[model samples]
Target: MAYTLHNLPAKLEASKMATLGYARVSTQDQHLTGQLEALKAAGAETIYREKISGARADRPQLAKLMAALQPGDTVIVTKLDRLGRSTRELLDLIQRIGDARASFRSLGDPLWDTSSSQGRLLSTLLAAIAEFERDLIRERTGDGRKRAMADGIKFGRKPKLSDFQRAEAIKRRAAGETLGAIAKSYAVDISTISRLRA
Candidate 1:
């Protein structure tokens, strides 16, 4: 089914929902005319446009659109990809919209319309799959880290001082040299010299 404004749920129609539009281009040189026209024709009362990469987490216009959403509001995008860079990102954005008591629609992707029953079901399924994929990746990363640790692979930042330098620092500390003086000699922090053990 074509999830157009006319076909929106009766509850939404009765509430006099606002149709907000978002249009984005990846770069400054890219044009937003096509997207703007489509959104206008689709009955978008307010349109938000941005010239920024979808991969970026910070989108000022998108942020404003999200903040402007009200209960029963519908956010329309020219395409799903224009809204998010990946499926996970798209799902997260939709979930946020749902949390705001609003809905989302993509003029280019009918299955993404949350106003329809079928679209809601598909979106829920996709969200579950994305969550499962994230869990699997986390599990794999943990397992790999454990294996590397078992092989004596060290993690985190390397020790700042060499073994000889560490011993010398400890000796100097034991000999009543000030931590600041020892640190100055080695060009290391006073905390590093203070942390040295005999």
Candidate 2:
């Protein structure tokens, strides 16, 4: 069924299952007319459009479309890249639609549609590949971290006090100076001085 922006809410309220569309453009200069027309031609009753990078996870319109999903609803996009840049992110979005008892379809990439058996099989394979990619990234990151640590590279926040200042703070504490006094002298927190072992 064809729907315009004016009657979209009324149509949505009347139908239990709706064909929802999402169209995205990475930059303000990009045109959404093509995607919008394609989605409308594909029988999308309500189209959500956003001008934002697919790499960003905090897309407001996409979030709204996801929230508006109902059981047996179908979410259609012109292309897979229009939905997300990364395979993991696309799979995750599709999984969320499935969790909501809805399905996804890509007009440009027919094999990515989740409403068919072939598409489901391809999604399963893609999910496996995404998992493998994540594992490789984790392994590489862990190895790099280990190498950096072995080379004396420190991670996390820098120490607030230098070694000399720390030693002096401990000595001052042992000599009966108040933590507040030591902390004020070093321009550090009182908790920092209190944690120093004498």
Winning candidate number (TM-score): 1
Top lDDT model: 1
Report the CA-based lDDT of candidate 1 relative to the real structure: 0.88
Per-candidate Cα lDDT values, in order, are 0.88, 0.87
TM-score of 2: 0.84
Q: What's the count of clashing pairs in each model shown?
A: 0, 0
List model 1 lDDT by residue over 1-198, tens digit each: 112334657685557878989999999999988998899898887788988999899998898889878899999999999998999989999999999999999999888899899889999999999999999999999999999999999999999999999998898888888999999999999998888788
Model 2 local distance difference test score: 0.87
Position 163, candidate 2: lDDT: 92
TM-score of each: 0.87, 0.84
- Show model 2 residue runs off by greater than 4 Å: 1-16
RMSD of each: 5.5, 3.1
